[model samples]
Target: MKPAELRNLGIGAVLVALAAIFPLVNDGYWLSIATTAMMYIALSTSWSLFSGPTHLIALSTAAFFGIGGYLVGTGMSDYDTSFWSMAILAPLVATAVALLIGLATLRLSGVYFVIFTLGLAEMIRNLVSWVQNNFLGSRGLYVLTDFTEAHIYWMLLGVSVVVFLFGWWINRSRLGFALKIIGNDEEVARHVGINTAWSKVILFMSTGFFAALIGAIVAPRYSYIEPNVVFSPQLSFLVVIMALLGGTHRLWGPLVGVIPFTLAWEAISVSFPNSTTLFLGLSFLIIVYVLPDGFTGLLEKFTRRAAK
Candidate 1:
């Protein structure tokens, strides 16, 4: 294989080993931080899968994630379902919702898609909130599971690995090529016999499914979740910012983006508490102005200079 391909394979193998080994060695604070970081990595990477290739800025992460959490919450509380089944059911449920939304909105281009996705997430949030207030007495949902922190860490790690591999596969596949063409110009892609609509729908559904899966796994980790927390638009925005700030074009960019930002975020949250969001927002603005291509682009520039 070529040197670059070999390097990527080596790196992937190392990452997989590290993820598998982490939970075994650490259990307290470090495990919690690592688990949260892994969750963000999965989330950002999943967002990048479709957004990077298609140039469609999606804002529906919370919609699917919140839905999955609620599904698991209700299923366990009301119907006596198991965590194992909820994992499968959550993604399936999100995929179905994604398919309908994708079919309706994927045909629209540019800002319209973004607006629809953003609006859809908010709409769902409000609907769920209303349901909680009237029918469920505004008590919100409590996710109960017997899984330990190690189990949760492993689950999130597994999802992160799958998301990474899926991103790598897409980067090398026919779908990737079509997406590149679509990203450049959807009309041109369609004229060239690529089914852009269906391609986009597939991407949408895949992202929705995995985002939901992450939510399902993460929900039980949290003691309680209301619509405001689970369906927060800020969650959608955070992943988008993480992916963009990391560089969305490359498969590894989001993962790179998640690590440093997550660490920094944790530090800032501890130090300033109330100022965490303020600092994060400011940093994002700086990143947009200074590192348009993100840290990956910065790394590439340095590597080329070193080669020279």
Candidate 2:
């Protein structure tokens, strides 16, 4: 297998191990942390498709993921949408929405794109509020009245697997090559006749799909969905921090980030009780400023040098 293929397989193995082991080692506290981490993995991995590969740092990833949460939430409560069906449909719907977002904003790159996506997230959040207030007659929606944490765990695991595999697939394909080019230089990529617009659309759409899939799972897990939780500025920050801190495009980066960050978050919350968010903020800031490629990138570099 090529290096990318090997990397992908290694990641898959790690995820499988995590899924199998989490239930055994995880209590309510740990399980909650693990599921949140998995959600981060899904969100971050997808964002990496655009931000890491295409160098199009989209800030609106939260919008797509939040939309996913609402998608399955509304489907379940108001529309009688089955969990299984929304599980299948949320990603697709999110992708379609992302396609429009990508196209409308494809002309921008780097920080510009990032800002645009931020605006998009805000817009979506407001839209969610309006819809809920007018249609649902509330500011949030809820799902499961009663369900097992294990069910949430399994569903999160399965969706995380899907997103991880999708990232692996894209990282090895023609589109991936196109994205690498876009990452390096959009002008050069355009000169090379790559359909920059289409690639952008596809990248956003792909990421949006997984983001939404995670959302579907998220709504059910909480049995509630609120605009802020779904589309919060903090949501975007968390995923971006995870991706950037974990080596962005590397196969194991998301998992690396999700695992440690989740653990730290839980630990800090338990120990400090009152300063959990403060702890996460400080950790991410330190990680970004000191080791932007994340711990996984450092590990990968050491591994490669050792191999040499």
Candidate 3:
């Protein structure tokens, strides 16, 4: 393995060790906070896996997430399936949906791509809402909530680690090279014999599968699943902001962005309550102007200057 890979393994080992022990000393409140942070990390990194390399702006995070949650919720309620069974099934469903959507929309780029993705998510959300209200009853579905907070925390941690490792693997693989080429110039990539569309479709489906898996496993932590809550646009936007704030070009950028911002989000939400969204919006705008490449890029610049 390369030195960078070794370093990443060492760092990941330390983080896994620390996360494993966190529930031992932390209270339920802290454990919940940590779990939320881990969930955001997983979501953002999974999102970065596709959007970072391809430069496609997707707002379907909540769509996949909500679909996974609903799959679990409905499966358990309608068929009495176990959590593990639903967890395995949700990702498959998400992958199918992503394949269809990616194939349809991969041809669109730039702002048009963004709008279509966002529109697709909203359409799904509304369809889900209508179904629940008409057939499934207006009330939200209840989840099996027997698992302890520690178990949920560990699950979240595991998902985060898996997502992170996948990002690292892709960034170092030949697929990453192809993505960079496509991102730079899709026409050139095609001229050079790269199958850009299929590459994007594969990535889109892969990321969707993981994002759905995370949501599937995490769904049971909450006692209830509602379309409006799970499919909120804000949830999608949060992942985008997290990835952007961390730096999209590097595998580790989302992790770096998620940690501090998750903590700050918790604090800001508590302090401002009503105005928390406003503050977050302003913060994102400021970061775009000040650190266009994100915190990871800034750190790289600082390290180079220090070395000089």
Residue ranges of candidate 3 with Cα displaced over 4 Å: none
Model 1, residue 270: C-alpha shift (Å): 2.0
Writing each residue's lDDT as its tens digit, candidate 1 over 124-149 gives 98887787678866375667778888
Give candidate 3's TM-score.
0.95
Give the top-scoring candidate (TM-score). Answer: 3
With candidate 3 superimposed using the best TM-score fit, by how many Å does residue 120's alpha carbon deviate from the native?
A: 3.1
lDDT of 3 by residue, 1-308 (tens): 98977987998899799988999999579898988888888899889889997888788888898888888888887678988889899999999999998888786666665777786667888998788778877465778768887887888888888887777777778787889899898999999999888888888898789878888878888768877777777888889998899999887798888888889889988888898789778878977789888999999999999999
lDDT of each: 0.86, 0.76, 0.84
Tell me model 3's lDDT, rounded to 2 decimals: 0.84
Best by lDDT: 1
Clashing pairs in 1: none
Instruction: Provide the lowest-lDDT 10-residue window in model 2.
Output: 138-147
Worst 10 residues of 1 by lDDT: 136-145
